[model samples]
Target: MDASLEPRLDFVTCASPAGLHRMAYWEWGDPANDRVLLCVHGLTRTGRDFDTLARRLAGRYRVVCPDVVGRGRSDWLVNPAFYTVPQYVSDMVTLIARLRPGSLAWVGTSMGGLIGMALSGAGAFAKAMLAMRPHAGMLPPDQGIRLDKLVLNDVGPRLENGALSRIGQYVGDSSEFASFQDAVAAMRANSQTFGPHTDAQWADLAKYLYPEQGGKWVKHYDVAISQALSSQTAEELAAGEQILWRSYDAIDCPVLIVRGAQSDLLTRATVDEMLKRNPRARAHEVAGVGHAPTLIADDQVNPVADFLLA
Candidate 1:
């Protein structure tokens, strides 16, 4: 850890159908740097998940890691239905307008990956989205938040039901732990697919996973997020898959898909299809890891740093 590499906490207010909520983000490197990297975490995680990777590339890019609404220091949605991807995309649009980066790149894990995929193809809706904020006039209407590059970490257009079900089992779990170590242990058990981590690394990630509430360590995210996850019907899921596929097909920027070799979420078949569908895309796998590579290990971080720099 870089003793001097701590991030500045920041917040951006986002609009939702029910009302407005604040989204917290950790900003690193030079704030004036126009070349920006937006790092988003997975479901049930907070922005701190990207601390290692953000520090690695901070000198070259202004890295911003957000605790997406309903998680971390961000405000939870009044209505759980607002927890979907479209809302996330809209919130990001407002954020992009605020940053107004000269160039932009994305590093999204799991749910974050899907948000990136959706936003990459959302240019046509930019005008309407920009209307949400009057001062958003800084971003030109025609450009519409185009990404220079995108990295999809352990995610794709198609998500396996079994893996999702595995996640569902604990997504909204209301259990509280008596101590932080106990909470970390519980989180680690559910996150076995994240592959192995040093005990220190595990503690680092868990620090942002829960916050003291009622003098107990509880899950950081709004439990209602699980309500949104569970309410989706099969037809709704299929429709979303089609939309994501179309969005993925439309991406023109250089893309990288990082997968865990033993992942049950992003399968080899999906990666194969992704490569075939988009020539600008490439894939890399981390051995001995499942669902996702934490991007903290040297091998994991090196590949990502090289890809972003290239």
Candidate 2:
């Protein structure tokens, strides 16, 4: 089966204090299949980042990849402040309601992994806070779907300040390129941490990174997403880290932590702590990668598939 041919575009309306916005998604495989796998992209990426992985998994699961709000084809938030994890989590809750799957699995890279950790590990108080929102009325009657398996790609509760600072420096840079090749070169330079990919793979990845507009190739996401990172102070990040640890501990499902061997974002110390906290959590280190491991390669995707299928 042609995975590209199998995917269909769809949208879900999600609510925010600023109002409602449409979140776009790509669905692959049998829509009727109750076993669902959700693949969410990194901080600056769109849903299309998972095209290769989604295609491979489509035969066994209904794969859904959403362009998180303010990225890809998803509508930008009326309030840039709403680009934080809480809002992302709320939007995902809305999406899950629409999918209504019997069993759910998650693959989250970078910021996406943070969102998954929030949803999968939220405690009673966190759930109550989410439910108290005005849009809570729109959530599924069961609240939200529980994850059966979770793949967190190069992110953990504890983050390296230096790595975050480096990411923050470039997260909002939206330079225009004269040609597609130029854009590809820029992406390759900035994303060397995503590890090595062939010239063909980099070309494929560039398609989603740059969207042509008015005859110029521009970055695919809304620039305001950077505000979410810029507004976070060190103290706030520390507090947030505490919250993430609580949530990570609350998770009952099997967890897979995909760490790029050279990652500066998720440190070996943090991975060790995570495993200590959750006995069910295991680590898979992708050699040569830095901040993240894009699940485009068979070596990266196979371990994830085996974990989910096991």
Candidate 3:
């Protein structure tokens, strides 16, 4: 990739119940642009995942991709229990305060989509929280935060149990590799659902996923981040599902749901229901993709670009 197309790496301190941790973000385009676009990664992915997409859309907006604490260059929480959406949402709000963008939009993949839903819905509450006492590392001006547009990549209000179980098995898998090739192969095998990519593309995807560190190729994200996910009971999941649905329904902004045609996660029925529930919502499906569509390809990126830019 060209150096000019690459994003500027930065970090922001965010408060957790345990303590403060730094959340890393990659910035692209003009810093002075008030129209902001936030691109958030998946369960075990990093902010770098958006490099290709960011390159395409950066001209129109100041694109900011966050590692979503516990992944990529962000700090891991002292307590694994803090690895939930609320904590992630809080951190993102802090990032927004730091950016102070006059306008905001969002693109979130999988787990990141859930955080977007939660945060986007809490616009009024977030405004009030920031006014009083919010965990933004530093107090920022009480400017209201709202998502003018949102792109939910392969996720929705309800998650499929079987699909989630399959994802859970791999999320915290503590597999170690002796060689970079071996680690890249492992990631490709594990993420087949992300759809087709060239060999070089796969290499690029794995670069941030399993950094060469401490004499071994290990996953970038903190494996302990899955603890809270594993302990969720059926009742808890059901309650969480309701909360997500409420959030989805409450969203006042236009939403675009991107689903892989072969996805086991976000179903067609759910997409249909989302459109029915939110009049401002629409859907787009990628051919032959599953679980999620890596928004690198033109086919996937173009539609999202149109939606966010429109």
Question: Which runs in model 3 stand beyond 4 Å of their true positions?
Answer: 1-4, 123-144
lDDT of each: 0.87, 0.86, 0.86
Residues 142-177, model 2: lDDT tens digits: 233489999999999898999989998888897999
Q: Where in model 2 is the C-alpha error above 4 Å?
A: 3-6, 124-144
Write candidate 1's Cα lDDT for 178-289 as tens digits: 9999999998998898888989999998998878888799889898899988987887677667767877887899999999999998999999999999999999999999
**Over 4 Å off in model 1, which ranges?**
1-3, 123-144
Error of 3 at 94 (Å): 0.5
Tens-digit lDDT string for candidate 3 (228-308): 889989977887777678778878899999999999989999999999999999999999999889998989999999998
| RMSD, every candidate, angstroms | 4.3, 2.8, 3.8
| Alpha carbon deviation, residue 178, candidate 2 (Å) | 0.9
Q: What is the TM-score (0 to 1) of candidate 3?
A: 0.92
Superposing every Cα of model 1 onto the true structure, what RMSD results? 4.3
